[model samples]
Structures are given as structure tokens and as C-alpha cells.
Target: VQESEIGTAPDKTSTAFIPKQNEQNVLNDILSSLHLTPMDVYAADNTCAAGSKLTERHTFFPPFLNSSVARTKTLVHISELSKLHSAKRVVSDETFQDLCDSIESTGIYLYTPIYDSVNPRMPLPLRYECRQFPRASGYVEDPATGIAAAALACSLRKHNQRYFETNNDIVPHHEHTNSYDRFEFYQGTAMGRPSKITIRFVENKDQHCDDTTAVKRTTTRMLCSGLV
Candidate 1:
């Protein structure tokens, strides 16, 4: 399942899959212990993988904390946050800002740019996923994403506000104004999003897409003017 379209790909055998033992149990344990599923802790335990030993040396894991944390929100499938579901879940700037903060902690990004801006009837979706692996690792594709640039924009604003107690927040609306036919995200500081990307079925590889090119691609730039 790791290599399939639906799978979280990890070529190396040592990589952590779902947490060991009862994957659901750890989620329940941490969530129940704090009476809240703070995104950072949840993500930490998630990447920790139940069986994987907690190591301070490792890049992903950390030592025990002194106090419990709480988040006043429910975790939803990332798919639920799409434009298609915006009418129902329209997250406010505050929530979106938190999302950006939570995202930076994980170092993953999921960005969907609105394609076909001129025609409302012909809205096209762009899937920006492709990377030329990283140093110390051979060419490989990451399984999860967190749409870095936008998320960072959101996080930077919030973190700045929280840290300095600034009244002037980072304006989410400012991210717009550019014709973003391409997306540069977390796969790497070196990661590159081509003009168009294609995912073929069965085979695990990129098929330079044609349909994407034909469509007038435009991205959805959400401005965090205020709460939802």
C-alpha cells in the first residue's frame, strides 16, 4: 500500500508507517490525556510512530513536556478544507492562521491553486506534487504536503502577533495579486512546481500533463481579513 496512489509512500523499510500497536490508541491516549488534540503534539506522536523509540537526537521527536496543551478545534480531513467545501467550513482568518502555525511545525505543505480564474463555470484544480528528492537521499517523492508558502504566510503573521502582541497582523489578502501559475512549496527549498503536473494511474511516476496546460490556471488567494 505504501507505493500505491492511496498510500503514504516510503521506499525505505525503516520508515515509520502508522504508529505501532494500536495506532488509534496513541491518538486516543494523547488526545484524551490533554483533553485536546493539540496539532503539534498530535503530529509529533504521529511522525513518532508507536514503536519508534523517542529520541532527542532524531529530527522529528522531542522530550516529554512539562504541561498539557489544548486546541479548541476539531481535526478534519485535509480534503474537507478545499474550496468545494468552503461554503460549509469557511475557516476564519484566525483558524487559517493557526493552521499555518500548526503546519510549520510539521514541515509539510498542501496547496491547491485555483485554475481557470476568468471562467467561473470552468474552474480547474491544480495538483502541485513533484520533487527531485533531497540531499543524503536518492530521488524520492514525499507522501504528505502542507502548502508551505501560504502556510508560512499565515504562521508568520500569527506568530508575530502572538510574540510581539502586535495589532497589525499579517494580511492574508496581500498574498494575492500575482498570476501564480506555479507553486513553490516544502518538497524542498529546492522544490520546484512546474507549470503543470500530471499523475498517471497504476504506474508510480509523473506524466507531463497536457490538459493542465490547456486550462487557464489561476490560484485561489484567500485573504485573512477577519474571522470566518
Candidate 2:
């Protein structure tokens, strides 16, 4: 596990997070509990551009059965979820249930960046809502999920870079880039077990620079701190 510190003020208290290990085993356990089998798990690719909403669907077969046997289907939707004025009203009842039933899955994870209701253009944090329905376990929503939060941060970083590269007209200079990305996640509010997650990404620029491009081959290091 890796840990880092984050604080807004010099003397104020800071919070940090350490990522968990044995992810594969944990994922398998979650699937098994829902009577679904795990499949080939891979990191999300940078396919969609920044600020673009999209959905990806996948299917997995039961562990003991062949491909022809029953399969579990899951859908993941990425979008800019609505903003909340207060934590007391985190999500609208109709919108929340509609999203939960939109897809059938061992679990459904929806990734969205929460913005300030007063200033819709300004992002307040990132959040993911998890819903699960199984034959034996019934329907339930997870209070918090660390893995899904991390995945969302990764996707945002990739898409942000793509956005800058493609939208040169908006950002004329290469030096002025969205290089430093930070996400603070608020989850479990709907279940009354509110959780906070902070994820930060710092991009490393290549030392050698020509007149062609201000920076090149920018690599990123992600640091996350909070409870899962």
C-alpha cells in the first residue's frame, strides 16, 4: 500500500489513504458472494475523450460452467452526475433508482464528478454509486468502493490529457495544461455511512524539450488517501 498527505491549510489537519493489495482475490470474493463468476479484469482504456459520456458493457460466465452456460452482464456508465447543494440531499430518488435499474449486473458502478450546485461549472469532488442485485442476496447499494473510485480517477486523468491535445483552440499554450488533477470523493451518503476519498495525480514532464512541444511523454503518478 502507498500513502500520501493532503491538506488545504498550513496548520490544518491532513488526511491520507493507503491502497489495498490482493485486488484480484477481493474482486473474486465479491463476485462469488453475488453468485457470479469473475472474468478477465483489465484496467479501463483511454477510449473516450474528455467530458464525453459513454457506457461500456461486459459479460462473464459462471466459474464452473463453459461459455455456453449462463453469463452475468454488467454495465458501467461514465457521465457528469448532477450536483448536490447539501450532503443531506445527495441524490434525487427517481434518478438514483432509475440508474440502478438501467443495467443488470453482479454490481453496477456509476462514475460522476460532483459539482457545486451554486456554481455548476466548478467541480467539488468525484463520486461513484454502486448497486447490486442477485438471486439470493436481493438488491443493495454499496456504501463505498475504493477500487471503483480509483478506476474513475485513472480514467479522468487520461481523458483530460486527450481533451487538451484535441482542443487546442481552448487551451492555446502547451504550458497551460490541466497537468495536476485532484478528486475528492463523497460516497455512502445515501446509506447514511458517508465516506471521503481523495485522489491526486501529478504529471512528470520529460527533461528534454525542443521548440516543437512544450512537454512530451508526460507520465503520471496517482496518490489516493481515504477509507474504501
Candidate 3:
């Protein structure tokens, strides 16, 4: 994952672009191909309901494929990762092939972020499932995907903007430093080669003089770490 991390220098942190997908038909097509109803895909932090149209689209380039198209990573809040694992086994090969052909992404990445405990202050951990369609290359289910992890991090920030702003008490902060959030993605478990990707990001920071609040500028820095 993330270009094998070995014998490679990490790239600089870059801005994450958050786009909107207003095409209802596109979302429907993707869900139809996987034999998954809209209920299978929901937003993180319970920001959106099942079967609702989510306009935010999170995309990123696969570090291994610089010349390839951007991959779209989606958050699937279907209660548990076991449900997705079962669905993946039942989907037809033809359906997956058609999905890859119809979509710009080379694969479909779905993940669920669940809180390990009932405490609200605890961090959320993610369980990822990635299916590389046969049409793009071969029908392979990757054990781990760094691209999806990065995209999901950005998506979570965007979807939880309100919660982050209003719930400042729960936001992790430090003296003489900007407040930030951390996310851990657990992947490859279904295939037995489990891995964990950790992402830490710093959000907007503003400064003011003479008791006047300055203009708000968003600064997002994403740092990723993982085990093979």
C-alpha cells in the first residue's frame, strides 16, 4: 500500500480537493453494479442517512500509478465489515467488469469507520475493502490501499466540519500548537494480511490583532503511516 513504502521517499503533503457529484444517475449505476442498495453506503459521523444522495466526492491518485486516473474512495457505513465481505463474494464478475468500465476509477473502495467503545471522545478506526475491477487490470481484491485511506481522511474532515467546529471541546489540542485529528484505517483483514494506516491532519487556523478576528483560512496537512 502507498507504493510499498520501502526504498521510496515520501512525497510532500498536498492539498486535498473536495468535489461535488450532483449526478444521481452515476451513484445509482455504481450501487446497482455491486448489488448494493443505497443503504449500504452512508456518510461518516452519521452526517447523512442511508439512501440519501451525497454530493461530496473524494478522489485521489494512486501513488503507484502516477499516470492513471484518480480513484474515488467511498465511506460505506453498513454496520460491519463482515457484511461487505459477504457481499463482495456474491457479486458477479460481469457486474464488476461493467462497473470498472463505466466508472473512471480503476477500482471500488468501500470502508466503514467504527468507534471501538461507547465513549464519544475516542478516535474512530476504519475497516477497508478494495476491489480492483478486471476491466482496468485484473479482478483482484487488494489487501491494503493507501490511496483509499488518504481519500477517506479528506472525506471525513469534510463531512464532519460542523461537528469539528462546534465540538471544539472534544477536538484534540495542545499547548503552543494547532488542534488536529487522527484517524486509523484497518485494512486487509478479510484476506488475512492485515495492515493499519494512520492519518493525522491539522485543520483551519486563524489569527487576529486588536481583538478583530482575521479571515478564516483552511490549512489541511495529512500525514500517513502504516505497517505492511
Candidate 4:
């Protein structure tokens, strides 16, 4: 009879797989096959300079916060947000690299928010999972970002208004609808660090309905727990 060793090896350990330059294209192709839609990009200026306080400590802000702590920072917008079953997901390496390049080229921050659409038990419409790239700091990802979240909320509000206006029927029926939009977001799982963020958009009743530009200016509040 042959004796068999059933126990596991004591020193067995797992190793991380690092991709090589030659295989990058193949890896990018595989990632691209995972059903990601190309996003529309836009540019905006950071309305607040609070990020200056953050940069004072050698910390970095999203590209939207601009490279410096100036009054207005350039912000890059990647709209047409997508939804995923889980917050933990991946995008094409090429897409990610392009985003990084855009940040370098535009000198702004990039924000992408993916959500879970099927979970009905959750009170919110969807669970927001956001990823932010800060190329200026030489970091590929930030665990969490309030500025990005706020920027996203602002973008969504503008999109919503445009959607209603284009429908024709909805606008005439509900002019100046004072509705509050709430969003709950999660981030940092991509880096093994988890964070939760909450965002709220409250439209000011005094907002000028006559001017489309005025409608773009709305109030947004963001709450989060973690280092942005």
C-alpha cells in the first residue's frame, strides 16, 4: 500500500502575477471584453478652493481640484455613468491609461461612478461605487473623494434637467419641481480599503427657471468616512 500525505504544505504561499509589457495588449483586450461602455468626457472648473488645505499637507486632490489650490481647478467629467452588480469591478487597462493620460493632458481629475441597479431592498435607487484617479500625485487611485462625488451629483442634476426638458411633456407638467435627490456611494474596494459616501442635491426654490444656465447652479452636500 502506498502512503499518502493529506496535509497541506506548511510554507506554501501565493504570489502576485505581474503583467509584462508584451502581454499588455492581450490583458487590455480581455478587460475590454467585460462589457464596459465608453463614457462621454467634459471639463469644468472647480468652484471651491478648499482643496488648498488638503494640498498644504502634501496630500493630493482629484484633477478637478486642479494641480494647485487655486480658486478654480479644472475638473474632468466622464459622464453616462454605468452600473455593476458589485462595487468591486474592473475597467479596460487601456481605458484606465487613457483616463490617466487625459488627467495629465488636461491637468484635471477624473471621476467614474458605477452602481448596482438590481438590489431592490436598498432604499436608494442604486449603490454608487466610485473610482477617482489623481495623476498629479502619481497615485493611480484614491480610496474616496468628496469633491468627485459632489461633481458627479452636479453632473447628474444637470443631466436630469436636460432629460426633462427634451421630453417636452414632462417639463410643461412639472415646472420647477422641488425634488431632493439623494445618492449613497461606496469606494476604495479596488485597493482593499472600503469607504462609504452620501450625497444630497437640494434645488433652491429661488433658482431662476427662465435661464438654463441658472438651473445648473444647485446646492449639493456630501458626507463620507475615509481619507479622500
Candidate 5:
């Protein structure tokens, strides 16, 4: 929030979010619900105002299974999902199986959904459609993600590595971050634009790392903006 960023008194929107009174309790609740803690709550002022979007992170543990530090990659797409309406109904729980399975080994997941359109002026428009299913979602797994960047950087630092491996040759793998963020869908890498940024553990020596390459672009994804 920089003062210089506001020059013409751009219409500002503010909404109060219900904060968690207890962290551990919320975490327990998430586990019970097959959901996760650290969920974001969104809101707005009026019908003319944009609606709020919340991203709820979750985890999944295979029945009778165990591990250390978790082997899963980033499970951050759940909270970024939109209030999807299809010719049918909310995607069947089975439709989410792949997502759930992907996060299975590691036990970490996220669910982000938008209730309104980006303009915040009218009820959010349902634009994206699925060829086989009915829902909208986004996955985050790259350095361009500001919030994940620091965590990713920390992971690199922890493992005594600094290299990331990805299938997208367009990506340089070792990306930098600009700021803390949740806008990954609209983020960029050397491999052109990708919907997801799958991160791999790489070793590095820097105890403290700061990268901002992700923030260099405009995040057009409403999920990133947290505006529905």
C-alpha cells in the first residue's frame, strides 16, 4: 500500500474480515472438515461493490499412512476456486479427486473461491467453462507467487539447495520474487504464461533470500486480486 500508487483518489473498497480467535482450534476445525486453516475471508460494501473471495488451504493424509516434512508439492488451488455453476451443479466430489489425490502424499491443499465478478459492481459473472466439468480453479507453484516466493526461498535455503526443476522449459526454474503474493495464476516465468507453477526443492546457501520476479507482471486473474 504505497501513497504514490493512489493519485486520482481511485475508488477504494474496504471490508472487514472475521479474524480467528484461536489458531490451533481453527486448525483442528479444518482437519475435521477435511479442510485447512489459514483460510482467507473476503467481503465488500454494496451491490455496486466487488464481492469478496476466500482461499482456504487444506491437507490430506492417506488413511494409515505417515511421512516427514511431507513429500507433496504446492497444494494451493482449492481456496482459489470460484463459486462455480454449471449446466449441472457444483462439480461432484469425485471431480475433485485428482486434486485431492495430487495433494494426498504431502497432505497439504488449498481451496480458493470467488463469489462475484471482478468489477465488484454487479454479481460476479460466470465466464470460464469446463469441457468435462463445471467449475473454475487456479493452481500456484512458481516463484512469481510473492507469498509462496519467500516460503519457496526458505525451502531452498533449508535444503541447502537453490535449483528448481520444472517441465516447462519456458521457465528458468530459478526465479526471483518481488513481493508477498497469492496471485499465481497470472504470474509469469521464462516459459511464457502458465496456469500453474509447480515448484521443486532446490538447495541454496543464502540464509536470507529475496526475489521479486513474480511481482513484475500485472495479475489479471481475479483470484490473485481476491476480487470476484
Candidate 6:
């Protein structure tokens, strides 16, 4: 973080960590509970297909499964973070319980870009709903999750690159750039513990074997005001 950007604040502090990158397939087992389908259509069964259709109709892309600094989280993309409340009506208790037992994930992180609500001429940040549902953890959600915010920011960039090759665009034009991107993940509003996490990263592009354009890796660094 640049000193000028942070300003001359004596009270605020910052820290950084290198998050672990891991393969998380738990997304496959708990799809029904999250009311999501596999990213691959061929992997979707009848029930999964129904969930996929629902998300598609609602303008949500399929959930991107990734691991954070602490645990795995299924990142569900929604048009607006506020819509997650209404989603609870469709996600039944029984199915949600089944999801808790079926997977090893710490929780499902619902996220969306708040850009449309802001001026398109300016850069925008993403927000998050870090509702933890680890089996028997007795924790409902988090007040601040800087680590998860870092993970979400990196994964979203990679997700966008993967889609570009196929001409399936979801993210805005600015996000497609290989330059450093900044994101502010606002969470805990539902529980009255409003918190904000900020992250910045740059995608280091690597050419494919076929010489196609793609971003194969990213270096992420998180900066927050006294929030880990």
C-alpha cells in the first residue's frame, strides 16, 4: 500500500499474508444445499440443473469454489448482496443441514460487485457476506474476514480470465486488465457488525501452450485497518 493512499493516520495499521492455494472439490457435494449447480453443465443432474436455472434467471453465475487462508469457501456470485436474504426462503433447513454434514468447508461466502450502483467512470469494489456454516461450529457469521476477502479477490480475477477464452464475459472491462486491482469487501451488515476489508493484487500472465491469452497466476496482498 502506498503511504499517500493510506494518509497520515496514526491509529490505523496494516498486515499482509500469503494465502495458501488449494484444490477444493467439496463444492460438488454441497451444491444442492447451497442451491447451486456445478460450473460444468455435464456435471449437473436434474436437481442441480434446477438450481443452476434459478441462478441464471436471477443473473448469478455459478458459484466459484476456492480455499481461503483458513478454510474452503464456496463463493456464490449474486447480482446484489441484498438478494441473499430472499435466497434463504428457497434453501430449506433440511437441505442446509445436509450441506453442513456433506462438506468440509467453513462456510459459503456470498459476494457481488457494487459497481453498478456506483459511477461506472470510477473503479469499484466488491462486497461479501461471510456466513460461516461449519458442521457443529455453532458460528453463524464473521464480523470481519480479511483473509477471506483476499482469497475472493484473487479467485474472481482468475474466474474472469477462464471465461474470456470461451467468450463468456461476466465481469466488467476494467477487471479484465492484468494490472493491480483493488477491492473492498463489506461484510457483517446482516448481523449488525458491519465491517470492511480491502485487498489489492496484480495478475501475472502466463502464455498457454497454444499461445492463447490468459492469466495463469496472481500475486495477492491485503491491506486492512486493524482487521485480520
Question: Best candidate per lDDT, number?
Answer: 3
The lDDT-based order of candidates, best leading, equals 3, 6, 4, 2, 1, 5
RMSD, each candidate, Å? 21.1, 16.6, 11.7, 19.4, 20.8, 14.8
User: Residue 17 in candidate 3 has what lDDT?
Assistant: 17
TM-score of 3: 0.56
lDDT of 2 at 82: 30
lDDT of 1 by residue, 1-228 (tens): 000011121222322223333333533333232222323222212332212321111212111111101111121112112321121213343443433243222211223223233532221122222221111112232322223233323332233334333333232121222212222222222233323222111213333448555434443333322110
Model 4 over residues 70-184: C-alpha lDDT tens digits?
2112343233344222222255445555544532322223344332334322211244455654434455456776665555554444444544445442321122221225555
TM for candidate 5 is 0.19
Worst 10 residues of 3 by lDDT: 1-10
Q: Model 5, 134-202: lDDT tens per residue? A: 112242222133333223323322221211112121212223321111212223322243234332333
List runs of model 3 lying over 4 Å from the truth: 1-29, 32-35, 43-70, 89-95, 101-103, 118-135, 166-169, 172-180, 202-219
Better of 3 and 4 by lDDT: 3
Q: How many clashes (backbone N, Cα, C below 3 Å) per candidate?
A: 12, 2, 0, 3, 37, 0
* Candidate number with the higher lDDT (1 or 2): 2
Q: By TM-score, is 2 or 6 better? A: 6
Best by TM-score: 3
Per-residue lDDT tens digits of candidate 2, residues 88-207?
Answer: 212344433443233222233333333334433321222333322221223355556555456545554444445444544232122312223766666666557777767677778776
C-alpha TM-score for every candidate: 0.19, 0.41, 0.56, 0.40, 0.19, 0.50
Ten-residue region with minimum lDDT total, candidate 4:
1-10
* Model 1, runs deviating above 4 Å: 1-146, 166-228
Residue 173, model 3, lDDT: 48
* List of clashing residue pairs for candidate 3: none
lDDT per residue (tens digit) for residues 1-228 in model 3: 112110111122322111124534554555566556554543222232221112121111211111121364333334345555554533566766665454444566656545324343333232334332223444456666776677656555543554445545354444422234566677777677778777677666775545655666667677888986
Between prediction 2 and prediction 5, the one with superior TM-score is: 2
